[model samples]
Target: MSSRPLEPKDPGLSFGGGARAVLPLTIAVAGFGISYGVLARSAGFPPLAAVVMSATTFAGSAQFASASILEGGGAVASAVTAAVLLNARYGPIGVTVAPVIEGGFWRRFLIAQLVVDESWAIAHRGDGRFDLRRLIGAGLVLYAAWTSSTAVGALGGEFLGDPNVLGLDAAFPALFLALLWPQLRNARAIAAALLGAGIASTLIPVAPPGVPIVAASVACLVGLRR
Candidate 1:
């Protein structure tokens, strides 16, 4: 007797599965978003501007760095430069995910906007394959969580008083560490991370706010040869 062929997975189900897969991460993302909103509000951004920035940029590190720079009375050029540097990692991410994205220019453009580290990581399957539906689903959920949390934080900033007093200031860095910790299973990755941390620590006092991060990113190149 001949066996029936396996049915392809439904796109909607796949998308929902992806969203559920990353649901835990969404909590951390919300915490980070709230921290960013508080920082932006403390940095003198109006409530509307802070929420708008989160909605439009949707880049946590870049937004944080820019807000910090601006708060310190840094030049607009410096703030822009810091944001660019922080976001430079997306260049390779966009390249890696490009083939999986299908559609017209506008659709592709929208997809590109969602290519953050978390979504990209969730979308990448082993063996050089990607799940496009997962990418879009995770991105949509993260974007919504981030923007909504930002609005919550911004609107409630005055009532929250100092985020540090509430211990919310540590949320972003702790979340980042949690994300990075899982990837440090190999010796090379550990080495790169330690090297980056050392470089960033050394530069923190001498360099501008984002320069150390940009410089520390060079340690990632060590993995290219492996």
Candidate 2:
């Protein structure tokens, strides 16, 4: 009797299916990246900074916030504060997906860096059978797509001189709306969102850059658990 799973490793395996599944996610991520690039470039950030962020953080919202703070001539403390607030969601993602990662600490850390929302959705779709190769492959595709798109958009912004008339400002928000739409599938999520929003709106005036997000996240968690 073999204890192994039904599928075994094969060097000849193709990522066509995974690629297809990830295409929409990649395109969506790319769009956000492009938006970020445009905004950052227009804000007077050198192209290299935009590329560095997309390559390093690979997080759309965090990168956007960081760029905004920096572009506003805010100090390093402000930039880090914004980034930390934006990236707090990753801790939850790591907690939820820890069971699926069967690797050492280094591998886990690497994978965690790639555990953005879309990547997590794609990874979890594998039904507890996806190997590391698949996960890594998906992450790489997303990373490349995101970074390269940022570069392209940065260059485009440089050429265009401004994003106002081009309507690039709305791109990231539109993407966020689309990303968030799927999560509102259930009554629990809907309720949580409403509850969180109500609370956060009340707190927004008093809260710092990230307190609202944290407060809302906590409210949603409590709502979901209850």
TM-score winner among the candidates?
Answer: 1
Tens-place lDDT digits, model 1, residues 78-173: 888889877876776687789988989999999899878777766655333568887888898999999998988887844544445655556556
lDDT by residue (tens digit), candidate 2, 102-192: 7798988887777666555544432223444445566778888989989998888445344435555565455445545556666776777
Best by lDDT: 1
Segments in model 2 whose C-alpha atoms lie over 4 Å from true places: 1-18, 42-44, 125-137, 159-210, 219-226
What are the clashing pairs of model 2? none
Tell how far residue 132 is off in model 2, in angstroms: 6.8
User: RMSD in angstroms, all models?
Assistant: 6.5, 6.8
Q: Candidate 2: deviation at residue 225, Å?
A: 6.9
Q: Model 2: which ten-residue window has the lowest total lDDT?
A: 1-10
